[model samples]
Target: MNNIILSIIFFLMLSTIVFLIKSKKNISKLFLSILIFVGVLIGAGLLYLILMIFDNDTNISDTIKTMIPLIASMVAAASVVIATYNTVNGEKSSKNKTILEFIDITRDILEKGEITEKTTEILEQINSKLKSTDFKVDVLVNNGAREFFEFLNAVEGKEKIYILDRLEKCFYYEPGSPLDDLKKELIRKLKSNNIKDMRKLWVNINQLAGTPAKNYNILYEECSYSLTNQFIEKDLVNSKFYTDSLLKNDRKIVDGLLRKHFELKYEDIPIQYYEVYRVCNNILESNYEQIGHFFRTVHRTLKTINSYYERNSLEYREHIGMLRAQIPNQVALLMFYNAVYSEKGRGMARELLASNFFGDRDDFHFENNELLRSEHFLNNGRFLNNQDAHIAYELFTYNKESNKVYNELEKMEKKVVPVDDSETKLKEEIFTHYLFNKEKILLDKFIKEFHTVPRKFDEYKIFMNPKNNKK
Candidate 1:
């Protein structure tokens, strides 16, 4: 009886340790069944030993108790052992089935010889269903590739690409097969890219990426430029963000790409028409200096390409978020002032009128021009009330158009203010007094230049001439 009890205790301890070690592999509910079986076997063995030791008179019941305990323990251990095998095998079979399904789906894509929205969707669904399986598979395809051979070259073609695609398709039917191992082998084949393969690689990359206006070429160039920084080193003309498209009206896309390139590359991308081009909408309310810095850092490349330039002129005049664009109204204003300055340089006393204009004149309205009209009105109200010619001319050419603009300038301008009683102070006060009447001088010049005042200024002739016609 003592020997039987000792053997049962030893067997239970050994089985528990074995069960625990195997449990480490999966550690599922089979562990609880193993523990219960061992507990029942140990209890039965102890009970039989108690019956034997207490029944020393050798009764018929003592023999039955011992035999029943031995049979129960053997039965329990055998049942639990079989259940453990099923649990482990079930988990393995589920994993194997998942891996097989993934291999089959991947094979279908290769056999179809094309990728589509439907195909991508199918692949994603397979990824979802097979996530529980421990096998990791990542599919990498060159979106830009025209042929399988090109993709092969880009991935260095260490393993045969064409054959692998065919093999992947076949593995799906044999789910419990070596397909997982073969997929890993293909991944190994796709690791490195050579410098000579850059053009092909870039083309493949651009093909897969989507853009609203199909600016894939620009993206390809950007990727190339990022790899080499050749755009800066060679001083190449920065590529326009707009690619070849059907309608060809993508100015907004062009603007967005320009800003994105600048932000990403930190390279100077020439944004033409700086006065009108805005990098950020939020920057519109920013300080003039910050706006100026943004403009200066970006290269300005303006070209007169054709009638296309006509529609684009509107972008310059409006405030777009943080940035500002120059428009036709402002462009015409600058041109008029430049023409006036050029005339001044040429030493001409004759004030040029719209009728005398000879350069690029295409339906320019004197009143329609916003800058000219605003300046004319302001000066007429201020300095021209007193007919000061010099002041009117200076105001028209140099002064900013609005008081808000003037106040902004004053806040920016730094100068030593004059103290009272100094000689310089008196001169400043006198200049300040003259400056107040400066607008009158601008109105007088406008009257002389545009309103048909006499071109010849002779003191004796003017008195002889009609009073209204005096220069």
Candidate 2:
């Protein structure tokens, strides 16, 4: 029986040691664990003493044995109360409350560019938290960013973006710039920026990151993204986050976010076109294919946006969670997409027919001009009021018998076309306008939108067929 009890005590000690080794990292928590562990050991020792006292024939002292039990109980009870109080109080002031503590520390640092020793200590704590793999790792960073953003919104108004911009600029300046130089540089900016309210201009590099800013693109990007994301949360449109450009260095953050979104594999990609466009604007010149794949996220109506920009399996998943889209909205979006992608100075991609505006004289890609349907029409469904603009858009999108369009054009003087909410309406409207107006510019624009059609059709050969100009 003694041997069995000894084995049980041995196993308990082994388990306690393992738990201690695994969990006793924080100094404050370490004391609590040790205190509890010691209590266990003491209780075990006292019980063993009592058992031995009864088992052995030691002379006298039943009174001593009785007093021993009462004393040990009192000591054990007091030890628990003391340990509990210390651990709880330490926790309230330190590690577990790091989020709240970090936020206050960050705000103060941003307001004054002073980097104090407490800042360094907080850095140590922030780094330790970051080393943790659990979600709590981001608690300090996340809360700090949100609080700073709220502070900006409450006071700075639209100028908050300008202040946020300065904060990004100050924090992400030349990497590895010594703390002293960074301080001087910030002082110069503060004096020269001439903004009366500089409260929103502070950036706490220590609280945001536990290190210097030279190799800080990723950290800087995280801060900017966090704030912009908050900016978006506060107001989706008038404070439109995507309408503005981000620092060029932050492109990797965009790519990283895109990869995460791809991992989600949502059917309709929950992001707005403007948001994706901001990403594409950042990456299109550098990573055309990836940005192209990302651009495939327009609504189903402008299916060509997906197919034309980048045709991949991801583009065709045909889902977008609970969001729905209309043809007009998606078209306007791609118009912006096409113009941005086709702008000059994009390295070798500048020569691709896909990268030139439709109006460019040297522009030669007719098949890819499906995006022109959007260029001609406004997203709000109002601006394409000119009849010729509508005709030009129809010519590019609906690949129908050219002879039928020619016949409709020729006969429009006699009767109004019986067309409705269908492709037939567009054909009649376009043909009637072209037949009567017949302006050379309109004729040329119409043929250009359909440059792939056979060049020799008898009735439709009303002007120079654009297919002959194909490269």
Candidate 3:
């Protein structure tokens, strides 16, 4: 009976030790130490039982045998308790040390207002340490939020962009639950009114379309010069009268004079095409760098949100909605034009599409049945209707068919007979037509026959099936 009991106890102890070893990664040193101490006592008891059952010495008294195991257990237990206490204290100290180091590095980086390769390495270390079960993320988040905002406030221009870019890369590669929580907290901080500059950073980027020109006066001067030159060339201008009218800066007077003297209606007035282009070109030249930075900032922000939440989840929708609201109708319209026309803006367009930035039609609308006034410059006389915009949105966002079409168009451009216009212009025209018509069958037929056929917009009708072809 004694042997059987000892054997059962031994079996349980062995099983427990195996469990503790298996769980060593998860459990703290303190608990593991306690288990080890208990294991040693169990091991001593097993040895005593073995002696009684197998040795059959009959030399030692029962009291001495019992006392031997008891004393050994007590001594071993005390040693283990002291060791475990020291281990627990040391672990606590180490964790504290790691956290302090992380804080110090973060503060140094923030103060320096630069993120280099070293910064990334330090961030990785911080991430690794924070991933430990012993670390409390809430404490770090609470303390770190203010520091992060301070960092944002300190950096500007290219430096800020660099930081955001590196931070995004970090988030992508060094993801953990704690880091996710930190990202959420950082997002919340960004949205909060506590950091006015941070809020302005996002707001200003979204509001880029509000002011496309560096100087409104410069645009006015260019327009005035173009209009005056046209009037003089038409033999309709009284030079002094035109000069006085322009000085007054009254559009009605200018329009009335042009109508009465030059017989030019508002719509008939020659678009200052070259002047407008110059002004726009200047705007792009001056602010293009800033615009790229702004796009990157918005992309990184949305990407971070996207990483943590499912696309269809309520949290995702709410956050995305809040971001979308910051971009006004004109701005969204500008983004559409950028996406369509500019090479550098394509990635921004993709990010915007992923975030459903154009999910609402009303958000892209402006007064006077126009998408936006800037449309005149960007549309190449092929304006975007709501349906066209919606079709483009669907093709880009839902089906990813637009990208395929773009690729096919590129291939067709290379193979087909050269047109008078640039390849870009031809592609833009056909792509715009695709958006306008939303004719999938025609597109498919065009793709199939493009290699042999001349690339002309007028020839697109031939791709239509006879049954559905319009005269």
What lDDT does each candidate get? 0.33, 0.35, 0.40
Kindly list the per-residue Cα lDDT of model 3 for residues 1-471, writing each as its tens digit: 553564466556556644654553455567656766666676567566666766445543553465466446544644554466567658756644543444344334334433233333432333343333222222222223333345445545343354445445544424565545444444443445464434332222212211222233222222221122111222212122222222133233223322232222222222222222233234344445534444455555555555555554665666666665555444345454444334454444444443455663333433443335232122423322432344334433423454454445435434544345658788677666654343343234222322221211211110112333343
After TM-score superposition, what is the CA distance of residue 4 in candidate 3 from its true location, in Å?
22
Off by over 4 Å in 2: 1-150, 153-180, 187-275, 286-337, 340-471
User: What C-alpha lDDT, on a 0 to 100 scale, does residue 49 get in candidate 2?
Assistant: 76
Tens-digit lDDT track of model 2 for 1-471: 533444454456545544644563444555655756665576567566766666544522553455455445545654555566566557645532343333343334333533233233332332333233221212223333333345435554443455446446644445565543543444443344333212222222222221223253334322322222222222223321222222233333233322232232212222222222233354334444422322233212233222222321232222111111112233233333333223321211111112111222222223332223334332222211222233333432222433234334334534555566668868787766754463333334333433333222112111122345354
Q: How displaced is residue 12 in candidate 2, in Å? A: 99
When summed lDDT is taken over every stretch of 10 residues in candidate 2, the lowest stretch is 454-463
lDDT preference between candidates 1 and 2, better one: 2
Candidate closer to the true structure by TM-score (higher is better), 1 or 3: 3
Query: Tens digit of lDDT per residue, candidate 1, span 1-471?
Result: 554765576487558646664765554456656765666677577666667567465653666555566656655665666576677668756644543444344335434543333333432332333231111100011111223334355455533454445445533434444545434433343333542233333322223223432453433322322222211212111222112211133224233432333243111211111111111111222322322322221111111111112211332111110111222222222223222322121111112121111111222223322213232222332211122223223322222332232233333322424446658767687656654444233333433443332122112210012333445
TM-score per model over all chains: 0.20, 0.17, 0.25
Candidate 1 Cα outliers beyond 4 Å, as residue runs: 1-7, 10-63, 116-471
